[model samples]
Target: MTTAKETVAPSMLAADPLTDSVDWLLSKLGKHIVMAAPLGLGKPNRLLNAVYRRVAADPSLKLQLCTALSLDPPTGSSSIEKRFLGPFAERHFGKDYPRLDYTVAQRRGELPPNIVVEEFYVQSGAYLGARQAQRSYNSLNYTHVARAVASFRVRVLVQKVAREPGGTRLSLSCNPDLTFDLLTETEALGLPRPLLLAEVDPLLPYIGGTASVDPAFFDRVIDLPGPTPKLFALPREPVTDADFAIGLYASVLVKDGGTLQIGIGSLSDALCHALILRHTRNADYLQMLEALSPGLATCDLVQAQGGTGPFIQGLYGASEMVNDGFRSLHEAGILRRRVVDDIAVMQRLNSGNA
Candidate 1:
C-alpha cells in the first residue's frame, strides 16, 4: 500500500489481479478500511467482493463501503416473477457474473456485524424490508454525494472502466458520475489521494465526452485474469400508451436548439421516440399531437418555450448520466450540438468568430 508519505510514479504503476492481490491490498491499506465505489454500472464487483471476503473471515478487520447503487441480478421474489426473470437474468448477466457479497448477505440477513455498507442511493425498493440496509442508509442528495463520500476518508477507490484495444486511455464508460468530483472533494478536505484501482471490461462502451482519462489517473488497471465476467445489464422495457402520451407532451416542451438531460425508463424511451418521430415524420407527429390534445398544439407556453417542429439546429446533452436514449437521439441526428466548458470559446462560437 502506497502511503501519503511515499511517491510512486503514476503512469508506471503496474496492475495485479485481485485474486492474487487482495492480501497484498489488505496488507498495504490495513484492516480499518474505508472504501469508495462508483454508483450504478461503474462498480468493480469482483474486486469489491474480494475485499468483503477478507473482513468476513476476520471480525477484527473493519470494512465500511462508502458508495451507492450496489447492483444485484434481478431475481424476482414471487414464484411467477422469478420464473420469468430467472432465464432473463441468466441471459443478460451470464451464469458466472459475480454477485456483490454484501448485497447477498444483507438481503439474507447474514451480514457480518463488523462490515458496514453505507449507500447514499439504492435501487428502487431493493431494501424495503432489509433492516441492516435501512439502518446503514445515508440520505444525501446526488449532487452532494461526492462530498459525503470524501468525508469518509476513503482508503481505496475501485470502479469499472472502458479501454480501447491496445490503446492507452481509459474511459469511465457507464459511470463518470461522481469519481472526478470525489477526487476534487477529497483534496479540498486535505486528505491523501485514495488508492485508485480501475477494472477493465470489454462490454463497456468507449464514450468520449468528459469520460476519458489518462493512464496516470489510476494506481493499477486490472482485469479479470480468465474469461471476462459479463457486465450487469437491464433489458429495455416496452413502451406503453401512457408512456407515449407523456413522452409526446414532454417532447413539445423541449426547445429545438436547447439542452436535454434524461434518465433510463419507459417514459424517457418514449420521449426519445417522439423526438425522432418529430424529426423524421413531422406530419404524423402533428396528427398524433392533435389527436392527443388539439389545444396543446396552440398552447402559449409550448409556442414560446418550444416548437412542434423538427430539430434543425439539434440539441446538446447536459446530463451526468448517459443512457441508450441519448445514443438513439445521437443516431437520429438530433443530439449533435457539442458543448464545451470554456466560456470564451462558447462566446466566440455564438458570435460566429473562428
Candidate 2:
C-alpha cells in the first residue's frame, strides 16, 4: 500500500535523466505556462532553458513567460554610474545567466508570434523607466499572482528549489513567499490541475519558514547537474551621517519585542544598524540620541517603551525581503522573534497577552 508521497517519491527518483523528465512534463502541460520569477540561486535554469528550446522548435505554441524581476546583464552605457557598475557586474556575474531566452527575443523583437513575456516588476535599469517597459509591465501586486494564474489559464507551474540529498522533502529556498499563495489559488479555482514541476539544484541555500514542500505536491522533479546560478547580490549603500542620526531617532520609537516590517535599501539598513547599536552600546547610543533630539532620551515613551538596553527577547523580521541586513541582525543575535500571520494571534501578541 504505497501512499501518495511514496508513489511520487519513487517516480521522481526513477525519472533520473533531466531531458526525459522535462519532455514528460512538457507533454503533460498546456501550451501556456507560468513560471515563478527572479534568478534566485534556486531558479530552474536548465528546465527553463529546455522550455525555451521546446518553444523554439514549436512556433505555434503560445508560451507566455509570466514573472517578475527578470534579471539582465549590466549595460555598458556611457553614463558614469553604468561605466562604474558594468565592469563590476560582469566580474561578479560573469556569463552565468548571460541572457534569459525570452528576454533576449523580446529585446531583439524576434520572439515568435506565439511567445510573449509579462512581467509585474522589471529590473531597475535604464529600460525599466523606458516607455515601452512601463507600457508592457503588468503592474500586478504579488498577492494577485493567483488571480493572474487563473485569468491567464496558466496550465503549468515550474519552480526551483533546494533538495536534501536522497530526501523527498524540498525547500523553496528564496521564494516560499509566493509559492503557497499561488498553489492555494490554483487549487481553489479548480483550474486544470497544472503540472507541477520542481527542479533541484545542489547550490541553493535551505531557508526555513513556509518554504518547504513535500514530494507529493510536485508531479515531476528534475535534478540539474551543473553550476547553479549565482545568488543575486545587491551592493550595500553607504549610510550618511544624517541618515544615521535619523535612524537613531527612529529606533527609539519602536518598542522592544515588537514586530518589524521593513523594505530593502539603505534606510532600512541604517535603521537595523541603529537598533543594534542601541541594544549593544547603550551609553554611546544614548549620547548620539541626546545630541540628535536633545530631550528624546528622557521622554516618557522612550523611558517606558524604548531603552538603551540589549534585547532580551530580540526583534522579529517580517520584511518582504530577508536581505543581507536581516541576515546581519540574525547573526548578531538580535532578530530572533517569529510572528505568525493570524489576525487574532497578532492582535494578542500586539497587546502583550499572547
Candidate 3:
C-alpha cells in the first residue's frame, strides 16, 4: 500500500561479474514465496520438494498450485510450452494446480479458481474499428481491457519501481507493487472497480515498445524470483507463401537504417528475414542511398556507421514475451538500448543518426 522510489548500494557486482546492476535494482521489491515446485529449478529439484513441503505445512496461506511452466531458452516449435510446463504441473500440483490462463493483455475467458491472471489492453485503431466501426478515428491511445478489469475494484500489482538515484528498477524477487492507475481510469469512465489482485513480477524482462512501464509506483513488494514466468510457446498458424509476400510488403514501410519495434510471432520474423535479404541483394536501393549521401554509401561507412553486416544491425523488441529469437539477437550484440522506449531513439535509428 505504498508508492515511492528506492536506493541501494552497487555491491553484488563486486563478487560476481555476472551480477547485473539491473538485477540488484530489482531485489528491493519484495515478492511472495508462492509455495510450489516448478518442473525443474536448474538443481536436483531438491528446492522444489522443500518448497512443496513448506506450502503443504502452511495452512494460513492458500496454496493454489500452478502448473504453468516457462521453459528457459525456448526452442524447436510452438508446442514446446506444453511440452515443458504441462508435464511439470502434472507431476507436482496434480489436482490442486489450476489450469493455465494463456491470454495476453486481455482476459477473454475464465481463469482457474483462486488463480489470478492479468490482462491489460491499449487503445488501437483496429480494436476500435472492430468494436465500434462507425466511430470516428481519434488521435489518442486508450486502455479498454485495463478499464474493465479495474471496474472489478481489485488491487492490481505493477512491476516498475524507480529508485532514488535516477534510473528505474524492477524488484529482484519479481514481486511487484500494485497500483490502481488503470482502475482509476476506469472509474473516470464511470465503471465500478472489480475485486482484483495483480501479482507484479518486477523481474519480468523489460520490453521496448508500448509495453514499457515506469518504475516508481507500486503498492507492495513481494519476494518473487528472477527470470519471472517463462513464456510457454503457444500454438501458431502455419506460415504460407502469401504470408511471406505480405510480410515483404510490410517490410517496405521500414527504412534502410531505421530502428524497428518488432512484434512477437512468425510474421514478424518473416518480415525481419526479408528485410535482411533485401539489404544484401538490393543494389538499386543501396545505390539510391549512395546517390543521396556519398559519405554514407561507401562500403566502410555502411559497415561501420550504418551497421552493414551479414546479420541485422539492431532491432528492438517492444512486445511482452522476450522469446528465444530475441535472446539470440541480444546475445549477438545486435541489441542496444538507446534509452527506455524513446521515440527519438527510434527516429535517430531511422535517420541513420548513429
Candidate 4:
C-alpha cells in the first residue's frame, strides 16, 4: 500500500482484503478494471474475489481478467468420485481454502456479461468440457505472457507475496517471475505504470536471490489478520513405473554440470528423485536404469549427452515456474549453482572462470 506516514511502518501495514484492497484498487484504476494474476499458488484468491464481487454487482463496472493456470479444487463428476475427492481436496487443500470466484462462476456459465476471463494455460483437461473457458483462452507463447497481458492494457497486477525479515520487506516469493518481468516490459513500452498490489501470506517461505523484493515495490498491500489463508496445495500423484523409466532415461541425458528445469507433478517428482538417486545412490540408480531396459543404458543419446554419475558440480535452475520441484532439488544439494542476474558475472561463469 502507499506509504502511510501516520503509521509506524513505512507500508505493508494491515488492511482489509475485502474493503481496503478493493476500494483502493477502484480508486487507483477507476471502474474499468484490467488485471493480471500469477499462475498457481501465487494468486491472491480472497482479494480477487473481493474485486470480482464488487464489479459483478454493478452493471456499469467492467473487468477483463488475464492470467494463466487458474487453479481450482477438483470436484469429481460421479457421486462415488465426489465421495473420494471431497476429502482428498480438503486434505490437500485446507478445510476452508478459497477457490477463485470468477473461475467458479465462469465454469458454471454464470459469469456476468461485464466480466471476461482470459487464460493462456489451464490445468490439463480441467476446462476441456467448459466451452466458455476454451473460447476465451488467450493462446500465446509462455515467454510472451507478460507482453500479451500488457497488450490488453492491463493496469493492475495482484499477486501473493511473502515477508522478507522483520515484516518490512516483501518478496513476490511464489511469483516473482511475472510481476518483475511485466513491470519491466510495461516500462520499456512507456505505458502508464500498473497498480501493483499484493496480499501477504507469512506462511510462504522467504526465498532469496531473484525473488527478494522490497515493500516499496507495491502500490498497495493488504496483510489480512490471522487465521491466515492456507495456500492450495496440489496433491502428490503416485509415481508410476512408466514415470520412473522416463525419468531414468531422461536423467542420463543431463551432464554433471548443467542447468535444470522441471514442471510440477509426479513426472517432475520422478525426475528429481532419479537425479537425487543418481547422485546419492549411483549403484542403485544405474541398476534401475539397466533393469528398466538394457537398451536405455546403452542408448547413443544417453552415452553422448549423459551418464550414470553423481552431479559433483550440481546444476543451476532457471525456469518460468519455480515450485516444489526446485524445492526438492535445493534440499538435495543438486540445485546449488547460483546464476546471478549480472551479465558480466554470467559471462565469467560461462567462460569457466568464476
User: All candidates: CA RMSD in angstroms?
Assistant: 3.6, 4.5, 13.6, 3.1
Per-residue lDDT over 1-354 for candidate 2, one digit per residue giving the tens place of the 0 to 100 score: 222122233255445455565456555654655544433444465667777777778866657766777666665547997879777886777657535676666555566766666778666663543443455578877667657755666666677777756666788876676666666777788866666678776667776556777767776666655466665565667888877777787788777686777777778878889888877787888888878888888889888987556787788887557677788888888897757779999788667799
TM-score of 2: 0.80
Cα displacement (angstroms), candidate 2, residue 117, comes to 1.4
TM-score of predicted structure 1: 0.90
- Residue pairs with backbone atoms closer than 3 Å in model 1 (clashes): none
**Residue-by-residue lDDT tens digits, candidate 1, 165-197:** 678788988658688888999999999989887
lDDT of 4: 0.81
Which residue pairs of candidate 4 clash? 1-220, 1-221
Cα lDDT for residue 167, candidate 1: 83
Give each model a TM-score.
Answer: 0.90, 0.80, 0.37, 0.89
lDDT for each residue of candidate 4 in 96-125, tens digit (9 for 90 to 100)? 888899888878778898999998988887
At residue 261, give the lDDT of candidate 4. 74
TM-score of 3: 0.37
Off by over 4 Å in 4: 1-17, 295-299, 342-344
Q: For model 4, where is the 10-residue window of minimal lDDT?
A: 1-10
lDDT assessment of candidate 2: 0.68
Model 3 residue 245 lDDT score: 61
The best candidate in terms of TM-score: 1
